[model samples]
Target: MRALTVTVRDASTGPVVEIAGDLDYETAPRLRQAVEGLALEPGTLLVLDLARLELCDSSGITAFIVARNRAIAAQAEVALTAVPAHTARVLRVVGLDQIFNLYPDADSAALPSAVQPPPTANNR
Candidate 1:
């Protein structure tokens, strides 16, 4: 099994978490902890860069859900970038593809449109 590595960096939009190695039952908590520790603000986007992710099982998927839930609780948004083909397939199979905003790369996902703006009187 590959050693799981979860690293976080600040981005203009929000935090960009780069998850490498295996994201399975063993290392899922690490991700949970990393996400829980983030100070997410409303109208910001939390981007998960999965370009180096080698594996992702059900537990890993659950971790992603947990991150999403946390983001929602903060009134922020979460997105997945550079998702591996296999993991992407599993996410699609479970219908999470509709839940997360998928981006081709971290740069694109961190754009202003990544997280929806607060409803304004004109938009309402």
Candidate 2:
């Protein structure tokens, strides 16, 4: 199994966590920990750059869910970028495709308008 590597970098939108290698049961916690350490402000977009991600198993998907929940709790948003085809297939099968925003790349996902805040009642 490929060892997991999680790296975090800051962008104008928020933190971008680039995950590489295998994201399996053993290495899933590394992702969760990396996400937990991020400072997500309201409206901040947490982009998970998966371009280098070699593999993702069920536990990895669960870690993604955990990250999403944390982002929501902070009133922030989450996006997945460059998802591998196999992993994307599994995510779609589980209906998570409807939950997390999917982006083609980190640059696109980090754009200022990538994730807009929901319209408030006053905006209606």
Candidate 3:
């Protein structure tokens, strides 16, 4: 089985966690532990970069939920970036896509400057 590795770094939005490798039964707890250890703040976004995440099972999904709950408890937000197509499909099918904010990449997720401003009446 592929191993799972989670690395956390600070970002403009908040703390960005880059997750690689498999997120299965064996590795889900590791991710949960890592996220539980974070000190999230109000209004900050906890961005999870899943660009290289190999696989995610039920346990992994649970871990994601745990992370979200922890962030919410801290009054922070949560987002998922660079989600693989298969993973996206699973999230969509399970209705999790609606629950989590998704981004094209970590940069787009963490940088508010990259966000598109709402179009004005002139543009509409």
Give the top-scoring candidate (lDDT): 1
lDDT of 2 at 110: 81
Per-candidate clashes, comma-separated:
0, 0, 0
- Against the reference, the lDDT scores of all candidates come to 0.88, 0.88, 0.83
Tens-place lDDT digits, model 3, residues 2-92: 8889999998778898999999998999999899989898988888899999999989889999999999899998888888988888988
Candidates in order, TM-scores: namely 0.91, 0.91, 0.89
Model 1: lDDT equals: 0.88
> How much lDDT does candidate 2 score?
0.88
Q: For residues 42-77, could you state the per-residue lDDT of candidate 2 as single tens digits?
A: 989999999999989999999999999999999999
Query: What lDDT is obtained when candidate 3 is compared to the true structure?
Result: 0.83
Better of 1 and 2 by lDDT: 1
Model 1 spans with C-alpha error above 4 angstroms? 116-124
TM-score (C-alpha, index-matched) for candidate 2: 0.91
Which stretches in model 3 have alpha-carbon errors above 4 Å? 113-124
Error of 1 at 18 (Å): 0.3
